[model samples]
Target chain A: MLLALATASFRIESSFRAQFWFKLLSGVLNVIARVSIWQSVFLHGAGSTDISLPQMITYAILGATTFSTWDATQILREIGADIRSGNVVSHLMRPYSYPVSLYARQLGARAHEMLMIGLPVLVVMGSVYGFQLPASPGHAALFILSLLLSIFLLFTVSIAASMIGFWVMDMLALEWSLRGTLALFSGGLVPLWFYPDAVANTVLYLPFAWISFYPLAIYLGELDLLSSLLHLLYGLSWAVVSAVLVALMWRAACRRMIVQGG
Target chain B: MRQSLSLYLYLIRLQLRTRLQYRASLIIGWVAQAFGYASVYGAIWIVASRFEKLGGWVWPEIALMLGFHVLGYALGALFTLVQLRRMEELVRLGTYDTLLVRPVSPWAYLVFSGFNIEYGGHIALGIGMMVWALPQLGMDWSLLTVLQLVASLISAALLTGSILTMIAAMALVLTRSRYLFGIYFDFWELSRYPITIFAMPLQFVLLSVVPLGYMAYVPIAALLGKPVPVIGEAAPFTAILAGPFMVGVAILVWQSCQRRYQGAGG
Candidate 1:
């Protein structure tokens, strides 16, 4: 059933020719913007930082690609619109669980987008602004593992936030709040290394770090192999906790929707 | 023109009543928007300040640029936020038919209906940034310079609004303009830093093609006696004309698109 739903989503996504092109263009431009900012920083700014320009370039590429994988605002808006238009009730009457079905469909759509748009951006930008390869074979392997974990963690956290839309009168505020929190803590745009010690120390352990910072850190070999393994375990734990939270919230949201006939 | 202004205000008053109907939502929206803008700008500052300077602009200078950028965006968004979302929605749902029959110009009706005060958060924060940075710069302020600053900021706001309005107009023909919105924002993101950071060609594109540089960097650079990209010294003053020119272009495009609009039935 999930596969079928994913296929349906894939079909729906492929139908939008203009959106595909726009996504590709925007994705490429996003990488260029990030890279250019860093380039200027290294050139004109006091360049005493431990991280090399090449590493920073690699981080920017990884950050841009990963950031495109999920958008909290987009997800919340989809849920908000469904609820507002009363289409969510129809979703509830379906055989499968709404959240699970939603995830499956999102997975399909995102898979299409990442391949059709994300890969091209990664390739074109990676070549134009040289990016570093994974530090070592071990790091490369672990980075892949961490990357997959981060995607799951991001989805769980975002869906949990989206569930709050059930109670809120307006999802716009909730959407912006979630987006702001994730963008800051995720270290997707600016790496935590640039952050002051006191702040970085706290933000380092946040669940949001596991979303982008940790994965990229692992790929960049910022951590030793052993520490990378341990962090992956930690990230896995976050994924579990967030997934459970999503389940609980989904239950509570269903009760509220039924009671209020949303 | 005076009558249109009054009607716009009247429509806004009605919208305020409706928007305030949910007091919690209103407060939450305001806080969220403010926090969102604050965090993004804060992150930019934190990262940029790590270095001695970004593209030869000191940290304080960057702050000033950011202040202008955010205030301009907030003002632009205030005028077009509803049209940004509703233009495509109404077109898709076939409700645009009702809007066309209204006696008022569709542009005015849409703009007034979407007038939101929630952007007070961004405006206040932006002003706070400028206030903080201006004193630090220690520039000799003259009446002319002060007037120049005011003109630059207004130009920024007007250019932002005009650009967004043009994109919103695209929904008249292309029903799915959501991705174009993302593309537009990607371009907007470039103006946050000094355009000099980019290569010469990219800088040219920002100046000529998109004219995003006029939004903040070019004007601010001119004011601060910094080297302006493309055109020198006179760039700031030239930027003032960009706003009005773009507004004219926006109106022409909007009118043409409206003429070509076949309604949702098509």
Candidate 2:
């Protein structure tokens, strides 16, 4: 049933051919902007001697592609709308879990986007800026594991954020705050390596690190094999913790809905 | 023109009154917008502080550029946000016909009906940056310079409004063209930084093709005694013309597209 929902989502997304082109164009343009900013940074010889231009370029490419899979803002907005219109109540009537089914549908759309938009962006920008390969095959395999964990981690966090809509009427404000936090803390734009030691040390331990920092760090060979494995374990723990939190929040939200007769 | 101006103000007043009903959300949205923009620019600032400069732009100078970009965009968004964002909806619902049949000029009517007072946060942030950054730059604040700065800001607003209006015009011909705004925003992201950071070809595209440089970089550069791309010393003067030129172009495109807009069959 979930598979059917996902497939339907993929088909619905594919039908919007014109939107696909625009999305692809924007994705590609975004990578270009990122690359230009980094190029100028390195060209001017700013920052420390540790990180190189190639690594920053690769970070920007991956930041725009593989790691950019989900959009927390748009998803939260949808959830908020459902709550506002009392559409969420109907979901509870179904046998399947609402969050899981929503995830499945989003997964289908994201899969389509990654293939259709993400790959093109990666190839085009990667070729233009010379995208860096993984540190080694061992690291490459580890990066994939971390990437999967990050996806789950991000989804749980988003779900937890969405649960706020159960109480707050102002979802738009909530959405922006979530987006701001994600963009800054996720290391999706500037790598934590270049961050001040004080910030880098603190952010390295945060759950947001797994979203883009740790996976990209692992790929770039910033973390050795022993540390990569350790980081992946840490990321998994964060994801599990977030999942539990999301479940608790979901339960509370459902209770609130019933109490209010939504 | 005076009549249209008054009509626009009256319509905007109505929108403001309606919007005032949601006082709590309005304040919350404002705070969120301020925080959102702060983080977005904060990321760039982090990178800049680490590197000390970007394309020869120090953090202070970049702040000024950001000021212009945000202020101009906020001003433009006041008139064009509705058209740019909801054009597809209007086209989809066949509301274009309703707009056309109204006694007032549809252009003014459409522009003001969607008046976005939500950009108050952006305007405040923009002015704050400009005010904060100006003293740090040590640039002369002559009367002429001040006038030029004000004119340049107006030009930026016009250019931004025109660009969004042009994109919204596409909805008239192709109702599902909202995604083109994505392309515009992609460029907008690039504009937040120094254009000199981009390759020459991209810089050219930003200048002549899209004229985004006029939106912030060129005018700011000229004001700071930095060499303006291509035009050099005459950059600020040329920047003044950008608003009128783009407005003319946007009007032409909008008119032509509306003429071709057959109603979405009910």
Query: For each candidate, what's the DockQ?
Result: 0.72, 0.79
Q: Highest TM-score among the candidates is held by which one?
A: 2
User: Which candidate tops lDDT?
Assistant: 2
lDDT of 2 by residue, A1-262 (tens): 9999989988998998888888888888888888888888898846675888898899899998878732646778888999998889999989998888877887787788788889988998899889899999999999989988887877777778888889986788888888888778888888888778888899889999899889999999999999999989988989888888888888888878862452
Clashing pairs in 1: none
Q: On a 0 to 100 scale, what is the lDDT of residue B31 in model 2?
A: 82
Give the TM-score of candidate 2 (chain A). Answer: 0.95
Q: In model 2, which runs have C-alpha deviations exceeding 4 angstroms? A: A258-262, B1-5
Which digits, one per residue and each the tens of the lDDT, describe model 1 over residues B176-229? 566667878889988888999898998999998898988889878888888886
Best by DockQ: 2
Put down candidate 1 lDDT per residue, A1-262, tens digits, no spaces: 9999998998998998888888788888788888888898898788478888999999998788765433635788898898887788888778998888878877787778777877888888999899789999999999989988887777777788888888874788877887788778888888899988888999999899988899899999999999999999988888888888888988887777753543
- Model 1 residue A260 lDDT? 50
iRMS, model 1 (angstroms): 1.3
